[model samples]
Target: MTTQSLDESGNDDTIDWLDNGPVKGKSAPTRMCLATREHMPVSRLIRFVRSPDGDVVPDLAAKLPGRGVWVRADRDALAGLLTSKSGFARGFKQSVQVSEDLVEQVDLQLLQRCQASLGLAKRSGAIILGFDQVRNELQKRRPGWLLEASDGAQDGRRRIVGLAVALYERVRVATALAGEELGMAFGRDHVVHGLLKTGQFTDVWTKDYRRLYEFRRLTDDVWVSGTVGKNV
Candidate 1:
């Protein structure tokens, strides 16, 4: 994407963009959300492109060729565009086909990124596994974040949160992924509790998870079992 301009004149041009996240060694760029028609930091938006077949496809990396459209990470915005099926048509200035499953694709893609980052953090010895191990770690220091299974027993979650309260350790817990889903990163059949030490991988995983959170809720694919606690 060198340096391009956006205006009501409908001039869409290529501009140098860093798709992985925020830019470095250069100024951060902004793109307009087709659904909201608002300008925002590109890092908070996802890019889409039209294939030769006139099919709308998500370009999360923003490296796809051709004129592309940007949308807010929010699933509602994406769904609105797809529901009416005009946002892309207006942006592309051509009749296009929005994939019915594009929203799911975006959700799964972001989840995969989170899973990959979690695996990397684990490989670097930054991950604490099991309820006992996580409890021990929490007693010593604060972690980047607390990870719990979305489909696990609430007892483990309540006890952990209670421990955090007692230690005065303010921590954020995430249960967006199921126990079995998280286990994939560790080659285990199931994992209920986990913690990540503050580091680069933690930041990466959190960012991806936030995007997924905005996009949509998990499906039966990643959420297999357990009662996801609300208060804990």
Candidate 2:
């Protein structure tokens, strides 16, 4: 199913998918940004609103009250919006003070969003942790995705990746977070491998996961190296 939203100009716009498939269930109607003029799913957009003090605040949760504006969640897109001649001011229809660290702020918020979603997935029992559990789960059913600590051991990651690849043609392996971060999500000291099962929680977690993945890619800050299985 598709969703529609009204742009700043009061014209109806259809939001397009940025991924191969639409997220299951009813997502809120999408938003159109003044900077890009492209209607996109909210998951692919970063929201900002004028604070009571007239400063532009990043509303990662989209819960803040006020007239809001959205920018595509890309490094270049946000950088352009901030650098453009009066882009944000013109869009909000006011002279708002944009934060100098807006890009960093958005990146931090997106990271937190991804971490929170992973924690939620663990609580919902939609995730399996450790190499043995993940490998066993894969044998029973195909998971939605595999997660490996950026610093995890090459041996275990390679084994799991090979198994996932054998079962699914295109397996998503998230290596942006470290083992400690993954452990925090699963309520442990550290975790090197995890499997996200296909279910309701997967739908929610995947959106944040993809956003975090893209954000890291755009910023060129993806995690690259760490000792594997040190916790084991």
Candidate 3:
């Protein structure tokens, strides 16, 4: 079954089941950001705006009023934009107070977005947690994505990932979130591993997951290595 979901702009976007998995129809017109100057999908970029108070604010959902500034949804690119000589001022064509914690703010917002996506997937019955449950699901039917806690023990993670590799040759594994953060998604004290079934929500969650993953890579090395499957 398919459902309609609202994008950031409150426009109805069609979510349909494809042969491979669920996909979201494009909703917004893509724009090139002054920072990157590359035409790309809106989902792959972050938006910003100048506040009336002469401060720059992140319009992550792109709903904020006034002229919008676009930046690549990448940690390094954002950091570079913030640090570059007059990057924000030049982009907006006016001097504005850029928050020193802009990057951190973006990271926090992206983290929350990812966590919310996971929670929605769980509520929709599209996610399964625990080692045995995920293992069985993988063996029976390949999942759209695999998620491992960054702080999870290596042994359990390896076992599950190995099973995924043996079954599907390649599986996308997301280890961007820690166990506690993942626990929030499952309403538990902690979650070591999880699986997202192929569906509309999985597609939405994957976008947030990739942003969080990339943001973490730029700021910290807290992620556990080998947990992210390259094959997928």
> Pick by TM-score: which candidate is best?
3
> Which of the numbered candidates is closest to the native, going by highest lDDT?
3
Q: Can you write out model 3's per-residue Cα lDDT over 1-232, one digit (the tens) per residue?
A: 1111223343322322011211225675566655667777767778788778778788777777777677777777888777765666666655667777889999989988988898888888999999999998997998888888889999999899888888777677888888999998778999998999988987788778766776666344323332344433
Clashes per candidate (backbone, < 3 Å): 5, 3, 0
Q: Which tens-of-lDDT digit does each residue in 159-192 have in candidate 1?
A: 9866865675356667787898889877789999
Candidate 3 collision pairs: none
Cα deviation in Å at residue 226, candidate 1? 23
TM-scores, all models, native as reference: 0.77, 0.74, 0.78
Candidate 1: regions farther than 4 A off: 1-27, 217-232
List where candidate 2 sits over 4 angstroms from the true fold: 1-28, 218-232
lDDT of 3 at 138: 92
Ranking by lDDT: 3, 1, 2
